[model samples]
Target: MDRTTPRPGLRAQLLRTKPVDQIVSEAGHGTGGPASMRRSLGLWQLTALSIGASLGTGIFVVLGESVPLAGPAVVVSFVLAGFTALLSALSYAEMAGAVPVAGSSYSYVYATVGEFAGWLCGWCLLLEYGVSVAAVAVGWGQYVADVVHAVSGLTLPAWTVQPPGSGGVVNLPAALVVVGAVLLLVRGAQESAAVNAAMVVVKLVVLALFCAVAFTAFRAGNLTPFAPLGAAGATAAASRLFFSYIGFDAASTAGEEARDPRRDLPRAIVLSLVVITAIYCLVALAAVGARRWTWFDGVEVALVDILREVTGQTWVGVVFSAGALVSIASVVLTVLYGQTRILFSMARDGLAPALFGRLDRRGVPVLNTVVVGGAVAVLAALVPLGALADATSIGSLAAFALVNVSVVVLRRTRPDLPRTFRVPLFPLTPLLGAAMCVLLALNLGTGTWIAFGAWTLVGVAVHLGYGRHRSRLAVPAPVPAREPR
Candidate 1:
């Protein structure tokens, strides 16, 4: 096969041969077998998984940084970010219903746009999901340390608990969390989902308690300097909170496991967004109202601090810290699941090493999970939380832009396909989604852009050197036709 000839009508080959149903069944079951792992997830479990992935350290920890920038208007920023996410979710719901695959945006982009764009989207998502797991693990370690000190009156050495830039030797607790989640994933999806659901409940209960206590001490005067830095500040804060909205797409990634993906995927995506955004708004309101926004500077445990101030109760801080720990663990587990499945899709399509696509005796991608977990653990142990968060945001924003564009492209090219859910405004909604993602990307600082660009260059290099040569669609140049399930 010639490597530079654009794969001889590869787009048509993929479009005609790989239908939505075929892709969903392949991901849900196995390629060369009858029944693989049990399909235990229904719509409710699926929705909970999305919520578990979306509501995490981003909400509990990042608010401290955003509040100082937007004041009480951080509430407004939440709304703006939620609106942007809602738009993208609508587009995703449509495509997920239309395609029903494991790779989420990558699969959607491939079926709609082309092979190269799909590879790029998948590569960007690797950074988004893998880096996020590491960042959340770091946050989990801080919360766990705080909980231990509050209950036992004994503290671990700072050198062992903090990341390098934070003046620590290594982040032991963070690395442990990543390792633990990796082990859980190797067991199978059903077991992992059960654990994730329990963690989600714990996190929600803690946040609800914190909100109740903080609202009691709410002071109207704290909101006086709302939008202190004006629209620019609001935009910047929205960009930051945008990170909080990253996991809503997890609902779409589980298309294969969804009971009725064409119908359920869209519902789960929108429902998760609504539920998470509502919780975030209330949390933001309580945090700002509990104390002056100016006092949030240098604060890591924003909710715990608010609870401590509101009730003058040290126990409340301990409880909130416990919740934060559980929340971060759940985030790591679910994001790692999304990442491994994406690599599985890439491997199956011959875009990556076959090892990543192989399922173990438990019908789980054990090797891919271990590889991703080990990489993230190294990052968590060595990198600063701030740097990790910035890189995650950049990659997530790029992926979001690609997904939004993919939605528009698919609608134009495949109008006759049965769509379980559709974006109401057609081109308008998708265009807005793309524009919002670009605006958020612009709000990121120069350092973040440089990091993002460097990572993208690496992805480009991998594609040119290896992916282009191994892609199945490019190898034999199969004729385009929708494959039967």
Candidate 2:
């Protein structure tokens, strides 16, 4: 064997870059041999999935934290955040249609950039998906606590409710919810289009109930101090609340599974964003108007708590809490499924351990599911919910920025490629999208930036140490056939 030949020799192919042509050629087969992912989703199901994934936790859990940052101006925060997300979502739809694959942003990067850049994108997505799932699980635990208190008139021991660092030895409720979601994912895997639609309906109904009751108590006085902290405050809250809008892109991740991706994916992304932003703005207005925005400050289960306050009845709030139970679980399952499949694609490209890429007989990535589930459960039990939300937001912003950048690059580099959906503003959309992501990222605390840096550093080391050399792209060029021999 020629020791100097590329690939097959744990030699020094650490900085190797795969040909864009080869990467693009593998478009729909990003995950390699697809065991079983049913393409049963349509426009409605896709839209619902996007809405469900982004709706939960962002408002139900993080809104309270965000309100203190912007006061009544938090309503504006939703708009800013939604705008940034919409830009990214637009780019995602374009790429999803042009590429039409399972890897989401990572696959798009691989097809445009090279192996290392794709590795970085994949790493960032891990943060977005895994941390967001853990955060949702923690939020679910809070709703579970409220439901228990409302139903039985007894609060669970405080230690059993919060994450470890948040004055609790074990966040049992959080862990339990994570375990439940994990089991659901690994066992049956993706939710059917019907189930997803049902969950979205449940979410909309509960939100409508909150808006209706809260509006009954709406007082113009609550709007008196709107934007009291000014544009800076609204932007700050927008940065924090970015967590809420992360899921609209979940629709793009389902491109390969959509019935009519080119048409449906763009529509689903736009419709879901419009529907979700309207709900968020209404909920924000009603909540702030019903009770002073200050009242929402530091609330963990803001919406449900608002219900309890307005109705003067814990049981009434419990009904909304139950709805959160449905919404958050769906979010967890959707993001978790996205995470597993992404890593599966990375593994297929030799950027991760082979174990993660292997699918069981039923076409599910059982091992990947367990690994992701276990990590998320541990974080849900140990990390504080606020920190988890921040981590997820920062990671998501980075990935969103890269996705936008990829759109611009792919356009100039591969103009011949058919793009079923196109971003309306061309360079303007992608440039603004990337700029907004970086700007919002700066708003995150020093601690969050540090955490994101650490995660990226680890990913770089992993690629250098393991992935760079092991990547399947290391293969040598094929030999040409000789004279009829």
Candidate 3:
């Protein structure tokens, strides 16, 4: 800001934008101190991190929930959902290359839109990442119970394994898995990414095994009368299945830790989305083709059950459940990692409490990781996340819509900005990306809209009460004559 100019009023304070050059500079070191994140992540590790975050419960668990809605046409639902994700991913790749930062869309919006819009996007991200972590953890407990029963002939008491709303005293396993992920995160980013990469390999092999076995029993007749509920039903299922693609942007959150964020972030984001969508479609096809879609209703461990029914072998189901256990745990870890980093970025900008940006000796946001993990664990233990998938989808969709808007705004405002990646078709791609996100969000139920509204109101209050006043932009500084290109 120019010191000679008069202090701007409230509206200016609310609408001030962060410069992209400042964001890139901050990515290389901490904003408040000399301590910085360790830049150890490479392209493959970033791809694996994204796959680990995204390629979980959506296929292994939510498929059961969606199959009943779309019937055998759930395969088409996956394709529709994947297409929606792809449009936004192209826009994400472009913005990520131009303005690499840990806040993902939140930072992109702050740099391109303004402070108020950025805060709202960050708020939505909080809902998307934090709640999804708990929702995925809850799914993990179900597979844990299934694995234990299948391998040991021991049925864990429902009171201990299920959440309160689901008739259990507490979800013990859900909380424990979150804690396990926190432990791994505290060790450091590179170590955690290495473990996540290994888990990604295990899960891919597990899914392949499932496809090989399930296809052995595939019957073309099973896919007859696909979309029994009609195109409307397939669209509805696509809206829900969009949750399956939520973490494809997980790679963008690693901007601060990527060895070459400008290059790797865009490639990792698009590459991971492509891989995840293919696997999701392939898995959905196999599950529906192997068994009647009607049988999927109310089945939590649908894939494991499909294998059991197709082979009539308990060991096959046991193996699948064991793989899912590893699979879901990976989701918990990566999503939680993303949650902490989003907060870390916000804290640095003074939108969130400074504690969230604090680093440990290993350059890990240890306290932030623990705080986020603990909250998610508690939420998983108590809340029955029956509606959380829709809630998460709405939040993510809203953030993605703003990301597309950000890309357009940045192009107009800073045409000289360098970009390693550009969305093909120019405005057409980003326009469709924004339109698809809004369309998918509209497909969600009224309950999801109500919840999203309440969350947004809370965010507004927080911003007005705390963020606006404490914002770094609120303080006067030597104004840069020009922004970096």
Candidate 4:
């Protein structure tokens, strides 16, 4: 056996693992030729990115859908989902600090699990980030309609603002917002982070206003039958509500762009989750407490309507809708940014087309941004919000579960690696994280599972046809020696 030659066999090729040091080294060397991603994000900017990506959809849009499922117990549903996210977040923080690369869990899994698994995880992330961006964009469009109506007393044509089957020929506003975010992303990462940070602040303030006003109308009687549907309902709602926390890992995707990823990535992930969970709980409590849970059904802008009803003041709702407009757009921006970076990482590793790896002078992946943003916009224009949200939850749950497993695997496989942050309780924490991910995923609709399976099959075909042969780790056969004439 030649010591230098890669072992033969499909199994060996599939399980080929990249070394952790090599992963870190490639990132440091600027894998994108002359225009590598710049490290401009500090602790707060990274935290803001996570919060900005996370705070929008659940509170502004999905709360309406989730409340009906869980009734007033929806607050509990939020907590359950947040707890699940926190567990997985701990694992993400650990691996992110240890690896600190652009691909988030995709890179971590490659270093711990194998190339094929990493490719699949990255595929799941694509489903998560890309679809979530479209979902959030649709939510943004809802608020855009509301704002236009509030300002002009004229409802935009339903066909222009709503997805197909919901009366719209095309959701133009949703598509427009996705395009706007892409333009911002093309400028530079630092500029995008700064804009996102401002929007996050606005989001927090708007949520605070909602909580204060909604509490004024709170009645203890509204809590009479908290769990109108039962435990099963709450569990199901939590499965969908998991979409709310999808962007909590946004910071981890920016590992290569963080100024101090080893320390700041861990802190940003934990801090953002804690603050986001608290805000979500408070907002959910206020929402259901102020109004009967049944009233939430079919209300796309629940918070705006709640404010309008509670104060009998249309202006109040208008103000909140404006904030939501900015908030959801911020999410579309950050999640889109995360998706582009994930593709950039995969492309650099030869798992994706090289177009995704190219960057301009300012270190922005221009073509990658346009392609991803255009796809998300088309989805937003065509797909209904409910289906997009559910699909995103399933994909996110799978990616998170893999992250937890990667943490445990890496800890055992490379004890000598320096870990700036470690998941407490060792194997127990990560194991519980994986278990919780499965629990939530099982509660999702059968339709989502079917969609995920289809997506996985497509990913497998892409990998076998393209990535397997092109991967940097795929060894070439030794050329036949030529006999001397």
User: Candidate 1 vs candidate 4: which has greater TM-score?
Assistant: 4
For candidate 1, lDDT tens digit of each residue in 1-485? Answer: 23333454544543432344445556754333343545567788788888998899878888898988788899999999999999899988998888877889988887767777788889999999988888888888888888888899999898988977687999999999999999998888888888999999998998899888888988999888877888888889888888888999997777666667777888989999999999999989988888898999999887887788777889989878877888889999998888988888888877899888777666677888899889999988878777778788888888888888988887777789888888998889989999999998899989999988998899988877887777766555444555667
What would the C-alpha RMSD of candidate 4 be, to one decimal place? 2.2
RMSD, every candidate, angstroms:
4.3, 3.0, 3.6, 2.2
Give the better candidate number (2 or 4) by TM-score. 4
Candidate 3's clash total is: 0
Greater lDDT among 1 and 2 belongs to 1
**All candidates' lDDT scores?**
0.83, 0.82, 0.91, 0.92
TM-score of each: 0.93, 0.93, 0.96, 0.97
RMSD of model 3 against the true structure: 3.6
- How close to the true structure is residue 98 of candidate 4, measured as C-alpha lDDT? 96
Which residue pairs clash in candidate 3? none
Candidate 2 lDDT over residue span 352-376, tens digit each? 8888877766666778888988998
| Model 4 stretches with alpha carbons more than 4 Å out | 1-7, 28-32, 477-485
Question: For candidate 4, lDDT tens digit of each residue in 460-484?
Answer: 9999999988898886656666566
Worst 10 residues of 4 by lDDT: 1-10
